[model samples]
Target: MRQTRRAIALFLLVCSILVPLPVGARQAAANPFAELGLPELAVTITDTAIEGAPAERTAGRYVLAVTNDSTAGAPPVVSAGVGFLQPPEGMTAADLIAFFATMATGPDGGASPVASPGAAAEMEGPPPWYYEVPLAGGIYALPGETAYTVLDLAAGEWVLWAEDPTAPRPPVAITVTGEAPANQPVPEADVTITMTEMAFALDQPLAAGPQIIALTNEGQQPHFLVLATVPDGTTVDDVLQLSMTFMDPSATPPPNLSFEQMQDIANTADLSAGITNWFSVDLESGSYLLVCFVPDQETGIPHAMLGMIDVVTVP
Candidate 1:
């Protein structure tokens, strides 16, 4: 099981570099929220640091544009997002950093355990502090790609980071004050995908080519979207069987189908409940497997195994 988990992680890391941007260009022509006149936060991730976060801003909706400027040799994948937390009065950013360090080490003063389908069920629950910090959804983009997401910031202290622990960069702290902007219009979406308990609901058929996708987490727990292209004649049952082999430690993985056989086209960071975000993607005409690997809060099983897996045809 440990080997299988490691193989999957390595596969994701490799896919981050090999996956082609669905959109042909590296940058988008305009901000999706440009018409709303919202503040635009330009976040650039390079080899050295994460740049463009302001020290303070008025509480309101803003467009977060994340650009990956890292070299091919640098970390090819970046998960940049905003995390909101309201610590007790008088708490400082340094205090929060210390808290994060403790969380990373777990209660045993050792490294935290990797989350897996088998191990998740054995856990009691996340630490109490986990609920205190809410992650605002962000982009999961590769080098040279720029992705956008809408952030509705409230008056509070928010931290922006790469969300990768091995990167060794400090989180950027922002103080949001004043009233939030009112009556902001939601950006138009080409297709809307709603996440519910152990299922995904699509408002319309997903067409081929570049289009804005709106993702809403209506489920009680957090969820994410991952779309990968599969060969012709592939079915949802085939995906389920492959995933089951990967999740089970005792089962031997099938030789015919492996993670390397699929091409991952889209991956989004986890979004908390009631949070809606948009991303743009373009896919070739083919069948793609949509699955969410988020573990269930109660059973620790991945949502994909519980009927969240589906094959959508892009025509």
Candidate 2:
């Protein structure tokens, strides 16, 4: 009887080890693209240059895996531009380099890329546009914070470059050679954030976890989502006060938490007016903020100041 009992116990233990885990008990998968059922274009970004970018790809729904491989320096940020760079008549290499440098400085205190000299006219407009994705190594450098942007690209020659002027790598040239891939099923969004001319509208707060957030642009201009975590006790007023100094340099900035204290998680690249796009993000539980920093073409004022800023809670 004792021997039969031992054998039965051992068999049960083995069966338990071999059996599959219950769906609810299994850990959630982390691949953002896989979870969303979208094709992925893995792109590695470093302080010097981008690597593993395909020279040619089929135009279609693609999730850009923009990984910030820079383990040092300021946190890295990247953006993609699709267009030909045609320097104006008789523009020198030195001039071209200077033009790129100026463009990299961003709009705040830098000269507009639209009006720069030399190759300032390099990028032809209308078809030319840029998109940005926020990467990890932020305030806390939280793991698995890789940024993603879904792009429905058309067949054409495209250019991808880092928005950070300091990155040493040259621009990458990509050719969209084939037809776009088939559309994938859109994942259900746990939280949907609607964006207007200069404001953000969300139905309610978000529960922390791997989540799909849908961004709908209902305004007349393009906008993007930057997910950031503010320090505990930080309020909307504190953010606004700091903004005053940013908008008007002469104004005494609030002594509240500056940019250094905030941790950026991810960003949804530019969503054109009337266009909607969704991306997957690992939402950690914390106090967060959503803002669109894109400046208005007419006023040159950041959309965040136009009431695009909002405090978000991820519990």
Candidate 3:
């Protein structure tokens, strides 16, 4: 009887540990929110210029732009895009690298990847362009961007980067915030800034980082997003800070903004409906106008005249 009780107690004790689970495992299983808070992150896409881009890019250069920002949270991002094409026939991106690692020889005396010239020689395979679609951690396209995939991204501050083994060896580093962002996507964050029938329709304001400004089709018309900002060479303090506590709608673009400002408005025109696009920028907190240039170019009437402008705040 004593042995039986002892055995039973031992079995019950083991079962208790197994049934309740370890503190960490239980925490992981009970409610995911309690551990990671929420899987959602503040990831937004933009076409803004890369914060750290090498002036000249050629072979062995990297081009990167912010595809997504998780705000200031971590496990840094170390990733590459999937659209990298392999070298054909006998050569490859590796060959390109090998070609450069050695001394450049004259026609009389060349290097390892050299032997003769053929139809294949002129063809550099990947064409030195590693195309990539925007990327977001938690927020992703349901069908996925067919042209791109997730490459090895180490844990640290990282942004999307592309490498070319050709000439113009420039290095581009997209901004990757030094923090971790929500690992989930927010449907509401996918905003559509449409311009049609001379009216603007945006549910909320844009922050100072990255975002996706989608343009929908009312007709077969083209639309764009434009906002006002300080003139070029202006300091951050000179920026006109503005925000809509109640989501206002009367901001306007500055007169004669720089070429970059103009491009910022046009780059958001990624042509995949229902598929969100991404861009990143380090913008100053301020008030600005958002409008689209979807008007008939021949008619000389601005797209905003048809109602694509709205007010937004960055705080």
TM-score of each prediction: 0.75, 0.65, 0.29
The TM-score between candidate 3 and the true structure equals 0.29
Residue 171's lDDT within candidate 3 is 22
Model 2's C-alpha root-mean-square deviation from the true structure amounts to 18.4
**How well is each residue in 1-315 modelled by candidate 3, as lDDT tens digits?**
222222222221211111111111111012112222332121223222223332222221111122322121122111111112223335443453344333223334532232121212132211122112222211111011111111111122222212211111212332222233334332223356554555657656566764444344343333323344433443322222121100122444234432233212222321211223322223567655554433233442334444445545667
How well does candidate 2 match the true structure in TM-score terms? 0.65
The 10-residue segment of model 3 with minimum total lDDT is 20-29
Q: What is the C-alpha local distance difference test score of each model?
A: 0.63, 0.52, 0.29
Write candidate 1's Cα lDDT for 1-315 as tens digits: 233233333323322422233322354345656776767888877776777889998887778887777664433233333333444345665676565555445457666454444542233433333333555666655567666777677787766654443243456778889997668767789999999888889999999888888999898787777777777677877776666554455666555555556765667766778888777777789888888766567664567778887888888
Q: How high a TM-score does candidate 1 get?
A: 0.75
Q: Please give the ranking of all candidate structures by TM-score, highest first, separated by commas.
A: 1, 2, 3
Candidate number of the best TM-score:
1
Ranking by lDDT: 1, 2, 3
Candidate 1: Cα lDDT at 136? 63
Give one digit per residue, the lDDT tens place, for model 2 in 1-315: 222222222222211111111111112234565766777877665546667778777766666656545433223222222212222334432444455555444547553222211221122211112212111111111222345545565566554544323335555656676786566566567778888988998866777887777778877776767677777777777777765543344656457666556655555545666555666667787888777765565654457667888787777
Whole-model lDDT, model 3: 0.29
